[model samples]
Target: MRLAMLDLDSYLLRAFLTVAEIGTVNGAAVKLNRTQAAVSMQIRKLEELVGVTLFSRSSKGLELTSHGQIMLAYAREMVALSDEVGKRLTGKMIEDRIRLGVVEDFAAGHLIDILSAFRAQNPKVEIDIIVEPNRRLAKLFEDRKLDLVVCDITCLSRKPTLIWTEYLMWTVRSDFVADTEKPLPIIMFEEECPWTLPTIAALSQRNVKWKTACVASTLVAMATAVRVGIGIAPMMLTTKPEGCRTLDRSADLPGPVRIEIGLYAQPETAEGARYLVDFISRHTAILSS
Candidate 1:
């Protein structure tokens, strides 16, 4: 018997990709401007057409199945190609400027590489990026000084266009030993930093005796303090400096906090900003990993 040819619709593929990226039908619905039931039905229809279960629920939320994982790459390519073709045909490719704000952690990690690739693809598009704490970035976004912003979810009142979770660990120099008997020396970010309050609250709740050894305004300064053995500092796993290591369970440190990173765009953002948003959304898996 001959195998049947698959007739995949671009709309269905887009819905599948959106649901997979967002991890919930409701979230995908909000992003796609569709109802929850509509998004759910679209996912079901796409699964039926593809003849496989695409998503499975776990403690975290909806996760892609093995088949869905394979489909993700193809779906993204197809959807992006479709959008590109549509834009080309409609003469929608416009050269514009984008003012973007990002948290310092991301600026130190993947933001440079991401921006390089975006610039390579869009040479005509000009980008101005400000690296600051999430709280400061949120303020700039609110003032309409930025066309796009990527920051911690806690800093924003609006829904994010893209979101991912990362953990903050208690990091210290490799050879440094914490004196549990004495008050722990902690290197903390200034009050404007989003993680500062949470880190302090976690230590206080755990009844851990800690004193601020250094208060730095930048992530680089905080890392330097940790490396020089000033004190332990909370840092994302990806941004932890080479000389520093995270305190494990044996260290009796407070549990790491899961922070949600959000990408947000203004309602009337320029074409360049929208293009950059799409580019970042496509690269979320790589960025998170």
Candidate 2:
């Protein structure tokens, strides 16, 4: 008896996963480094060989047909199997660098514990941690300079595949209550800080006069200013600086801003990317608890 040929190239599974997660042929094309037409063609070929229409297009985007959704479950399992096979053949999992960018506010909190866990799980993997404002972090991730980032964004452009929301609070010096009637002194990050949007919206709505007394590019500077009775700035409860406490301006501030923290990776690592995402997700639990 002759063995039938197998149309197996492990790359196909990864491509399929990207298309499903991103929901657009163009998005998947960017991840797979292929033209949109090429990506559509391969997906068509895969469906043809499998004898089904996997996805359907709509005004919203490419959505999985019921058949596609069912196949996605098996496709993930197949992809995992292929990775394990590759690892076995190589005698170890192939080492890769994960360039990670995060905002400084997270530095004072459980972010370190999350990184510690990730390092233990992936000891051979290298991580270059970049501490920057949310805007710069977004730019680096989009440019492929960073493989993953935990960003605080009101709305994300690259389409965060996974996200979690955290409550925002105001941090001010206890002594600053005396100047409540006057324009409040504000300690703020230079620009593009995640809290800036909500803070501005809150003050405008509350008819509060405010001016920046201290401007810094890093969270440390912002915390130091707030500690020395300089001004008020918004902070996440889990990430507040050691000496600072939340301001009791629930009435003056806009309802808690929902900071969406996310983990993003280029589409190629669709299978292995889960470990990093899960790590980040677990790390973010510190925010709520």
Best model per lDDT? 1
- lDDT (0 to 1) per candidate: 0.84, 0.70
Tens-digit per-residue lDDT, 1-289, candidate 2: 1214436454666677788879898988987789998888788877866778888998978888999877776677676667657777888853667777887776566477877876776677777888887878888877878777778655357666556677667787655563556777777666656677666776778777788888867777777887888878776777676766787655554345556776676655533356565445434555456
How accurate locally is residue 253 in candidate 1, as Cα lDDT from 0 to 100?
A: 66
lDDT of 2 at 18: 80
* Per-structure clash totals for the candidates: 0, 0
**All predictions: root-mean-square deviation over Cα?**
5.0, 7.1
Q: For model 1, state the Cα shift of residue 218 in Å.
A: 1.7
lDDT of 1 by residue, 1-289 (tens): 1215877899899788777756788877888899999989988998988889999998867889999988877787787778888877997765888899989889888677888988887788988889878888999999999999999998998767778888788999999888788998988878877777788887876788888899988888988898888998888887999978999765456777667889998866667887798888778876777
Clashing pairs in 1: none
| Pairs of residues at least 3 apart in sequence or in different chains that clash in candidate 2 | none
What is the Å distance of residue 80 in model 1 from its true position?
Answer: 0.9
Give candidate 2 regions above 4 Å deviation.
1-20, 25-58, 62-94, 154-156, 174-179, 192-194, 249-255, 270-274, 281-284
